[model samples]
Target: MSVILHLFIAILSLIVLLLFDYVRKIQFYKHAAKIPGPKALPIVGNALRFIGKDSSAAHDILLDIAERYASPCRLWLGNKLFVGIYEPEQLKTLLTSPKSMEKASLCSLLRPWLGNSLLIAPVPIWRAHRKLIQPAFNPQTLRTFVHIFDKHSKSLVQKMEEELEGGEFQVGSYMISYSLNVALESTMGISETSDSKMYTRYTECVNRTMELIMVRGLRLWLHPDIIFNLTKMSKEFYKCITWMHTTAHSAYDTVAVSLQYIMLMLASYPDVQEKLYQELKHIYGKVIPENLSVATEDLKKMKYTERVIQESMRLFPTVPFLTRKVVQDLEIGGYTLPQGSTAFISVIKVHRDEKYWPDPLKFDPDRFLPEEVAKRNPNCYMPFSIGPRNCIGSTYAMMEMKTVVAKILLKYVLKKEKIQPILTIKQRVEIVAHPVEPITIEIVKRLPNTFNT
Candidate 1:
């Protein structure tokens, strides 16, 4: 008799919650109706657009919606409202607001792997953890890691020797390995060689686990904890995680993704590459790139190299989208985003917006020239994002990418394998935005002493 009474009470509570949810959604639908978006079907809303798409296709679908609609437009994702903020003013309002400081529920998917890390922690927890992590990324501390960057980069170049005359080969593997080696050795003090059989297994497992996490993120139906646990994907996901060390770092994907893009861009634009090589020549005079050991002080001297890296990031931001949950009625892009709707900021759209950038598709590194940069709105270019919650590792990432790029350019001539415009390249945005096809470049060793300043 007691069990029957408990069941009746539970069913009553569930019905009450469902009724409340239905009423709550009316306000979202009302506002979303006023905003511009493709007409959504009942119940599922616009989820049909994402139903059969792969991650890259799903990414393109989102990009299409952002491109077709103006900044203040809305999309009904299931019963949820997602406001796309692409205009500069909208970005300023959403990014700077304390009310919008909370991450969207999608970020919670990372919690199973990352726990309540800085990436998905609540505002209060994030603030505290960010403060704690700041010292580790300080300029002084980052300078010390220049050696780590320098060491692994040289190893990276060596790993590509088989491909020296081996024709066009994928450089992403080399770059990812280099990124992992440097990050592990420096942060976790893992000196296990990235090339060793055991370390390779660990790296492979980590890669597979990340890929599964991305797949789950794309397939929205698997988002519920209970439902996800019932599937084979969940089993595979846990198996990979079990194989990985508890400390497998996930933050370095952006670094690896960005580095690969920069290498390809350099390969495509030789004149730009030549200019960068000249800067390296000026700074590291008589020091052959093959044997070059970049000092803490030398990092600052690569001004042109920094610009090249900056331009590459603008064209191909590793993490192109940023999402936050609206905590209250928020005014942005001339629209009122109701509380509980998600604010989806497309940094890529802003980066490619022709208003701020002339010849937006061109690969001109000089666009980042100080004089040119000063003329535009500061928020116009946010490869590492902007406002209070911007990426903390921006400085570290820049230094690391610059170190690797400079080292490689110093030794080998990276001839472009695919002669195509920057945007013409096929791309995928799952865990990170990267080319769908492997970025291939011919590796011809630059004759020693040819460009010694």
Candidate 2:
């Protein structure tokens, strides 16, 4: 009788707590009625429907709702309501607001891995880090690193040519390797190490860490601490974190890491790669002394390579979505959003929105053709995001991407490898999107003498 009574009391307490939570949510929704959204459940809200869907599908559903309501809309995940702010004007307001309205806890989860890196520090820390690191990516500074980037690109090309006797290879995987290499070398001033144990660990860690963050993002309502203690999932996450931190520290010392994806693409894409190689050969052919100081004039000439990198970013943006929270009762698109609401800016949708880009699905590099881009609105093409909190590493990321791509393309021919169907990468929201699988590609080489001879 005593045991049964205690059980009843515990159950009653849970019921009361759930009821109180429900009433609070109901009150919020009543006030938020002006904000359009699908009906909510008793306690979980739309989280039940959203929990299983990937980011792309969720955005698709949100788009449908936005279309149905004929304006920006709202979604409730548990008690937290997120309003979808789709209009360019509304986005401008949210992004430009002086207050920090865009704080998403998902970013908070990344602190364990990224540390105080510019990726997710508080605005002040973010500002300081951005300032300190800004010089590393200056056009002149980046140009100096061109030789360093080129050296690795050449080595990778040689490795590929030796491995594959010139055949069709999955070019996309190589792009992954190249991108990884660029990130390491450019960001930390490192070189590439062949398929070594440490290199393998770092690559694995990057992916695993990303996967853990995605899981945590999905289960934000259920505190990750509790989940971490109870499952093998947590073990894998911590292991990855350990490997990543150690490898990063090692790279800082050894000055060698892997640049996987970007170099891979350079190797596979013949036309772009050839053009970059010719430019490099022309610039370096006369035996200019290797100087760490690169001039602005050198970068100005690589216009087409810049266009290719920009186009690649457009097609495969690092972050597919951006989110923010409403701290107070706010109005957007004629809807009254309640305090403590969340808002997601669908980047993929915005980029591909037919109204903004004609033939949005097609990969036409010239769409960014100087004259054409001038005609378009800035909000339509924000892969690095925009406004005060925009990616501080924007200039650096672009320069690094262009430089690395330029270096590799200048030397090797990248062939398209047989890629399996693309799986949507579910990783931590960080500097860029990371795939779930290690992108595999066979690298082929074009002998340097052929072009000069």
Candidate 3:
């Protein structure tokens, strides 16, 4: 009697487990039924095909689909469904409906690296931080940072002067060093000499964390362990995570320094270098502080300088893509996206989209002139994004960029050297975009009266 009873119980257990598995599969298939996608394998689904790439294959695949479908389209990976919406109108719909279209869980991957910082915050925290940090970047406050911006920019020119003293020019490395030094000063409010060891570690942590985010995001398509074990990511991944936390903690103590460093690198352009100096002289006269920050009111007055800075941001946005998920069955551009679908609004593609910008490849700052800007679609150009969730640092970043540019232009003659076949700038994907190749240029000191704005 005991043996018979045990056999019955075992059969019942197997039946229960199989039923549960079947139920889960049905639920997933039901949810994903309407979405269209490439064929997925039984267990791995489309995970394997998506994981093999050097760059952002997921985004690239979506782009290809959008082109092929000619409107909003759907794709699937295993039981997961995705809706690819290309038009800005559709993007607006997704962003405005935050409760229904929440951020993807993939963003959770960034949390381990960037913390709950404004760059990746969601909903309430994102909104609150945006408000708190917005005032800090206001036009008035930006004026105070000009002096520091100019100083570091000039220092960058000095470094270039040393590098190209008698040889052919390369602006890539100089731009990188300048960018690093400027970020250090502006973000931390420290002098360039504050701490080299800390800065090196900070740079390393940032680079590694960015690489990890990109790699991990790609790995999501695969069954987690197969890739994790194959790559031996267990130990080193934890170390990178710990290092990221350390950097974020230290960042608080160094905000002003980093801001200054970033400003200096931005202002090193040849086209408007001299004019920037005159503006600096006009504002601060001969007397200037070692470290400076401006009030909100003064930043508004520098319109021309602001325009130039705005142009630079358009060319190089910090964040390349904006991702969101749908919570309900919805129709976008004639296609229906059921609840729990992932979406990405490609900011980079939009910025470079041919239909919107005339000669999008050219570098023309005047494209942002007041009259010209009036003709533009507000949604078409969002270097810092738009709506309630727009970048909080928009004003602050512009001010810093302008101030540094103006200051350096005033002191040096930045010359883009003869066209060389090898000169190039590659974008490094991270929480923010970084220049993979250094920018090199020649810097000759300008006389006091050489150029005037």
Candidate 4:
């Protein structure tokens, strides 16, 4: 009788503790009850809704939720609360806040791949590193990179001349190679001729790891480190990360993806391409200069080219979303987002919001003109993001893009090629948004006397 009484008492104590914890969680939920969101179930919350879904599908669901609830809505991933903000007005409050500078918890998933680099470092470390690295992208430094950019772009043009024989070819593969070469040479100080095979393998691994991480992020079962490590995916992820560390200090996945989109958009819109070509011709006339070295002043003069790049990014941002964690209780648009909550900024939806962008689907480079840009909220257009944490290399990226695009346009005219699917491209979201199918385009050599330099 004594033993039975002791066992019963222990079981009852455990039950009471669990009930107390459950009550605490319920109280926490009530804090955000006023905020709009999908109906969340007990224990699992919204986890089941995203289980087994790919990143692309998950992205669509997020956009749908944003549309339904509008800005400053609540989201539950398991027990954690995420406040989704899509409107520029609400975004300005979150993005510009110094307290909300830290990356969201979801970014911790990239630890194995990116390590504690500036992209995902903690607040103090990130600030220090940002200060140190800011000079690397200064105007003087970026001007030097223009030479490197031109040299690699010329190599890409030469390769295209040799390989593109009138038929259609996948442009993405070539663009990736070109961008990788530029990234390695300009940033890592690694020349394309040195350790070419290692660079190729490392890039392949980085790409694969990004895809796996995206899949793992959606599946709640893989959240715990112990469970994630026990799987084959984790094994491969670590292996790639190890190889990447040995080869390069940084990754240019964003630059590669951006180039792919630029090429695709140029091919899809012939009139846009023609206008861009005309701009390039005005800069460098009929006789193409064999030794083409674009100065910073020259790049500044290419206003139309810059506008085209901006417009392309508006339609297809390399990073479709950006996330930050709230370090303190904050009120925005009438709702209180408690401390420790994650805030997601949907760059894609905000860029396409009809309220700010009239005919949002149309490809119009003029939207980036000074007067037009001034008409809307500054935060509305954030391809490289805005505020203090914005991309440090935005200028370098723009210069590199301009040089590469100019070189290609000077040599060849890109035409849309027909495949079975007819290039009805859908974006696949990994670390960056990528086209579901390879983008292939037909290239024709430009007439010799088209422009006079």
Candidate 5:
């Protein structure tokens, strides 16, 4: 009876201490509490609402909340507060701010997979690495990748020809393979013949790793390394990390998903594809059988083709969201975002905002024409993000995208698979925005006479 009484008293004391700590932390976010947002529940706060949902669903919920409160809204995940910014003005202030250089704490989930690479590195380390790597993406260096892009793209076309038997097939897998090939060759000089089996294993591992990370992120109980490692999923996760490190670092999902969107958009709109093909034909002046290589000079002249790619990205930005942790207290839109606040920039919402994009859902490539682009806010469309810490490989990625797309367009006329409604592909956010369903398309062999090589 005496031991039981003592144990009860100890438990009561611990509960009291925990409550005091919770209140102290809540006071720390008093400034954020004044900001507009949904009313959070006590203790668990808003986290309980997102406990079982996938990242994509959770992302959609946040987007909806943003719409309800508009930009500069606060979200509470348990006791932690996140500010969601969608307005161009707020985005400009947040993105350009030097103090907001470090990635948010949530990005730590990516550490297991990406390691301490450029994508998730903190500000100081990122700066040093960015300076060292910037030269590799210069115009001269990127020009060398044009040939590699062309080769792999042609290889992609051949693979598609052999694989797609007129019926609808998912282009996502093939695009991933093509992008992986380009990334390996350009970054590590790994040719296709170097280790085909290893490449296959690496791709499989990457897919598994991403799926595991996304699922784990939503489960609060799995946040701790010890608990996560004990699970069966961690076994595969570590295995993937080993394979990834053995080869070069992993490629971003944006590269593959961007290609998927471009293909889907072109297929959905044949008129746009025809115009793009005509521009390509005018540049190449009839596709040569033996010489499918596109020069950098010729690729530069593809204004309309570039516009199509840009518009595709605008409609479906591969990276739908970007986040940053505030290193210093900042003020925006008559509200103070205290230091340690996480800022969530909704790229999807910003790109689709009717204020910046008239008839925002329409796929109009002409929106990218210099005159139209000049009329809009510079911060409105940022598929690759903006400011100093933006993607280092943006220029290289664009050139590669254009090269591969132009090559594919030169050989095939892409048409929608007709089994699904046009533009009905559902999107899911798993690190990068990807279609929840298979983006199926039918490819007709065009320029058969030029294919005798």
Candidate 6:
């Protein structure tokens, strides 16, 4: 009798609390009603839509919703309102807005692992940290990181030799490993060790925690701290972030994922690969690629290679979306994003949109050339995001990617005999987009005399 009474009391209290919440948010609900969205249900809203899906499927569903409606469309993840911003102009406005600095509620999922880091820090904190961190990614500082980038590239080449004779292997592991090491060495000043134990732990923890974060974000019921604390994923998440690499994980992880995609794209397009190689040969004639000393000047001269990197980012942007909570009423297209709603700026939408990119699905490095780029809207390309809160390390990331690719392509010819087309490659997006399957390719060793010194 006593247990039954206590249970009844708990249930009654929950109902009362929910009713109170509903009564207080009458305006949010009213605003959401006017906006168009996927079919939403009473009380639960559209939260049920994601019940059985994983992150990859969740991403697809989100895209479908974005496509079905025009820009600044509506979505209800439970009681919360999300306005999907698909148009480039709208994204540019929201991304650049001073008032739209607040991160969306879903960012709370990353708070524990990231711990008030710049990525999720309050606007004030982000501003302060950005000031301090901005210098590290400047061209001058990033230029200094070239040797470390080249050293790691050489190490990656040697590590990949085992795959030379073997069948197609998932090259992501090797590539990500190299990227993390560069991220750590260049950004964190954590010197590389022969064993790579720390690198493995860092990589695993990042992937695990990010995967869980996306899962929890879509499953609105798991939003509550009290309930989420009980799940196994929550425990694993804490263990991953707390185990090692306390902060700077997001920085390094983003760097790594972008590099992975670029490498895969280069392998997929042999014609582009050869053109890039020719450019490298033009600059460094008759030199040994395995031990080629990469200079900042050399990197600057590789314009075609830079174009390849840019095109790769367009096809599969590493950070697919950037989210912000509307502070004041944000106007996008004809719709108004209620002050409290989320601005889901979909990078994928603009990137893949045929309006901005004719035959957008095709991989063409020439699309980035100065003459061609002049013809398009400036807002159409933003792999590193835009505005005041853009990535601080964009320059650094480019320098490192260019260095690594320069070295690798100098030493090996990347190829895949039976490979899927670039656009058709499957992906799962966590903090960054990851190909569901491994990015694998064979590397044919280039002779020492191919490039003249």
lDDT of 1 at 231: 93
Model 6 lDDT tens row, 1-453: 699999999989988987897799777666767778788876677778888887788778877887888877788776678888877678788988876987887898888777788788889999998888887777787778899998888888888887776756777777777887787787678776666676677777888888988988888778899999999988898898787556455456666777778877777778888899899889998887765789989989989999999998998888888899888886678667778888888898889999999998899999999999999998889998888878777777888889888888887878777757765787787978888877777777776655421
Q: Number of the top candidate by TM-score?
A: 6
Q: Which stretches of candidate 1 lie over 4 Å from their true place?
A: 1-22, 196-207, 451-453
Residue 205 lDDT in model 2?
A: 75
Q: Candidate 5: lDDT of 76?
A: 75
Model 3 Cα lDDT, one tens digit per residue, 1-453: 699999999988977875786586564456455555555565446567666664444545645566565435555554455666556776666666654335766677766556677756777787777778777676566666666656666665455456434543544344445455655566666576535566566566656766766777766542364555466554566586787555434322122322222332333443444444555556655443323334334456666566556555565556666667666666666556665667756676666666776876544567787888888776778777766666666555565555545445545555554432211334555555555544445555656644632
TM-score of each: 0.92, 0.77, 0.73, 0.92, 0.92, 0.92
The ten-residue window of minimal lDDT in model 5 covers: 417-426
How many backbone overlaps does candidate 3 show? 51
Positional deviation of residue 63's Cα in model 2 after best superposition, in angstroms: 6.8
lDDT of each: 0.81, 0.59, 0.57, 0.81, 0.81, 0.81
Candidate 6 matches the true fold with a TM-score of 0.92
Q: Which regions of candidate 4 fall more than 4 Å away from where they truly are?
A: 1-27, 194-200, 418-424, 451-453
RMSD of each: 4.3, 5.3, 6.8, 3.8, 3.1, 2.9
Better of 2 and 6 by lDDT: 6
Q: How big is the positional error of residue 39 in model 6, measured in Å on the Cα after superposition?
A: 1.6
Q: What does candidate 4's lDDT look like per residue over 134-189, in tens digits?
A: 88888887788888888888888887886566677877767777888888788778
Error of 6 at 116 (Å): 1.8
Candidate number with the higher TM-score (5 or 6): 6
Point out where model 2 deviates above 4 Å. 1-15, 18-28, 52-71, 135-144, 170-192, 224-227, 249-296, 417-432, 435-453
Supply candidate 6's per-residue lDDT for 383.
91
